[model samples]
Target: MTPALLESFPPFNPEVRLQPPAIERWRRGTGTDVEFVHVLDSGRPGPTAMVVALTHGNELCGAIALDTLLRQDVKPLRGRLVLVFANVEAFGRFNAVEPFSSRCVDEDMNRVWDDAVLRGARHSAELRRARELAPFVDAADVLLDLHSMQEAGAPALTICGMTDKSVPLARALGQPETLLVDTGHAAGLRLIDRGGFADPGSDRQAVLVECGSHWEPASAEMALDVTLRFLRHLAMVDADWADAQLRVPAPERQRLVRVGEGVTAVTPEFRFLVPTHHLKVVPKAGTPLAEDGGRLWLTPHDECVLIMPSRRAGMAGQTMVRLGRYES
Candidate 1:
């Protein structure tokens, strides 16, 4: 399906539970020369850790959480802390009446992270912003890109993009119960999958946190809790300060969900057999899940779990859902 055709689908009309925080105060950052990028240096030498929000403009939970941290004047004790409000241009377009319309102006910002794509001739609002943010991303030793889901009722997950280094970082956060390990979309590379962040040998690691449903108030709290835990793990922020902000108890053990395959829509006629929630486990192999152009898509393995089943209109090559299995 064409982009125009996909966009013709109805606007998302979910009830707005989370209020979008006013970020005018943070437009000009201290320390970092860049706009909307705040850098806090402790003067003592340590790894630079970054927390990025608003990759998709409609996802407001991250924005709220980041704004809270900035307002609190949460500074690192040892290393540098970089708090970024990315895709602000797109974020400026967000409206409660039509939240999904503001996802991007040109293209998905998360998809254009490959070196060739950034250095190549292709230009868009997202590409230009990614290019501008490249320097900060390159310098970071550890990073957290915060995001939210389109579908509600899905459990929060930390997406560790097919790298061993990121696994421990996700484990360290420990609030989000599931850890999703994948290479990323077939469309292009994600920020977490870009350059040294995805390299196993490199100390640099990045994990994208899908906090929860876009418009849910709980999602914002989840984002804040996870962000604090991440900073505490890196020893960037004081333990007492970080602990005071947490609203949820840390998970005793995190379940590892290794993505087996992404079910991409081959035709626009993709339809799920039943309404499914995220982490919905199918007990048997060959269980019918979806249908595409008269062909039935079944579960490939027993105890198959569905992750992030798309509620939006499916286009050709778009990920309709992801199938995964639990690891030890």
Candidate 2:
């Protein structure tokens, strides 16, 4: 009775440079309804800023970033700061030897944020947590969900859902040069897209930052950097302290890539034709990029950029890569 994730695929043993912090110390977080959730109120009127980590159990960088903040006793200067360690059930099972196996215990926690799924009769470890976490997420005026890529050496990026509001904020954060503007996933709605954050008229905004490779030491640093930038942008933390804590320089300019579509693996035999360590562009239309059980994925137009090409090859029904193009 082995978990599906533990099933063998291609061998990938990347160096685990960042260690998962001892989170048990933060278990009874501020007496929140859910464990590992802390709320820091500044006792002044302002927007509620939420920062979440461990959306996926295997992504250690976010956990590290949140842990660092907790240890430092970071407090919001203007309003409430809600810190969450999501998917702790799955995260509790993390093992560097078989890292990906703990991404979730039942299903992806992120994809369970849809209203139907959350209110539905369906049961899963992720959905249950999402239900417990929904209220805090709904209460936020802004949210930053930290994550990392599955592939090593992949460049850092921010996932600004097909929303006009988030892009401007991401541009302000500056680092993670690539900003991916995408439609909500076909699988399910993500936490960032949930509630009023997705409404055009709503002031609330959410951004998901893909820090870097999951186990890379640099990813943890980038995670913290983004968290600081997010707080600084919202004027949540002390200006002097946040500025001193910042490590990565803001990018000179950020590029926005609007995702056209995601290439889903229909079969377990899907394979990409090229190495996708970083973002790539197919120079011409109709060029074959991948094949899955005789079905070929061809570029729809020239200069099509491939985003976040996955390392998990044998997983069917998952998005292998996203097709997008740069603006201007």
Candidate 3:
């Protein structure tokens, strides 16, 4: 959808509970020789894993977690650990009064991941940053792209791209109570779905963690907890170090939700019949969920779970939400 279409929708006002951390000290990274990219190598043979933050400017939880990691001087024990602050230019423009307005400086960074878009002539603040970070992302064996939600009170979720490789990894991290397996966005391929990360046969894997609401302090804690667990899972960081850093206990169990279909807006007048949160379940089939134009959107099956229901103004072909079912 176009920026004009997004602008047409009324802005959502979420309560701000967490203050954005000052990231000026991390502008010059210690490793990789790239700005805002730090790489710590143990000089031993193991998988290289990368944890990324700030894919969207306003998602402060990931940034805060990464910043804390940097300050703590966390280092890898066997493999390489790469910490990246993506979309710094957009993040530089973040204003507490108008947080959502600074999500990107040009186009959405997450949407410009396809090879054609990166190699093509299109230029933007986000594209340039992604281009610089692509080599690092492409080289990693494991990746964790941290993000947060727009909807208030929505539970944390792990978006494990349409494959089972990342499912075990998500389950191992054990935070964010819900694991969603789905194809990447229709708008574009995300970093988690790029190259080997999306290839089922390949050993590479990536998971996008939507920690919680954007401005919540708990979201930042969740981000750090998950990141530490991820590093521990890869054997990049010592278990003792990870345990010391963890703020909350790992989840007792995780519910896996496999998305069956994405509900894209076919008409401009799309509206949900009920207020939905992430992972909200409808117990019966044919239940009215939304309306688009004169058409009523109904649940396709019993126990249909709603995933990431949109709060933004609906544009034609924009994903309003996704329908899924529990696997375990």
- Order of the predicted models by lDDT, top scorer first: 3, 1, 2
lDDT of 2 by residue, 1-328 (tens): 1232233234667887888989999999774757999998999999899999999998999999999999999888998999999999999999988888999999999898979999999999998889899999999999999999887687899998877778887888887899988876777889999988888899899999999999998899999999998898888888789889988877778999989989888889887765554478878999777778888888888999988877776477788889999997
How many clashes show up in model 1? 0
Instruction: State the displacement of the C-alpha of residue 229, model 2, in Å, after optimal TM-score superposition.
Output: 0.9
Model 1 spans with C-alpha error above 4 angstroms: 1-13
Q: Model 1 Cα displacement at 163 (Å)?
A: 2.5
Model 3: how far residue 16 lies from native, Å: 1.4
RMSD to true structure for each model, in Å? 4.0, 4.3, 4.0
Tens-digit lDDT string for candidate 1 (1-328): 3443344233545787877789978999778678899999999989999999999988999999999998888888888999999999889999988888889889999999999999999999999999989889999999999999987655689999886679988998887999989757987889999899988878899999999889898789999999999989988888998898899767789999999889989888887775577898889999878878888888999999898888776688888889999998
After superposition, the stretches of candidate 2 with alpha carbons farther than 4 Å from their true spots are 1-11
TM-score of each: 0.94, 0.94, 0.93
List model 3 lDDT by residue over 1-328, tens digit each. 3443344344568887878888888888776678999888888988899999999989999999998988888878888888999989888888888889878999889988999999999898999999999999999999999999998776789999988889988988878788999966788889999999989889998999999999988889999999999988887788988898788766778989999889999888988876677788899999888878988888999999999989876888788999999996
Q: Alpha carbon lDDT of residue 133, candidate 1? A: 92
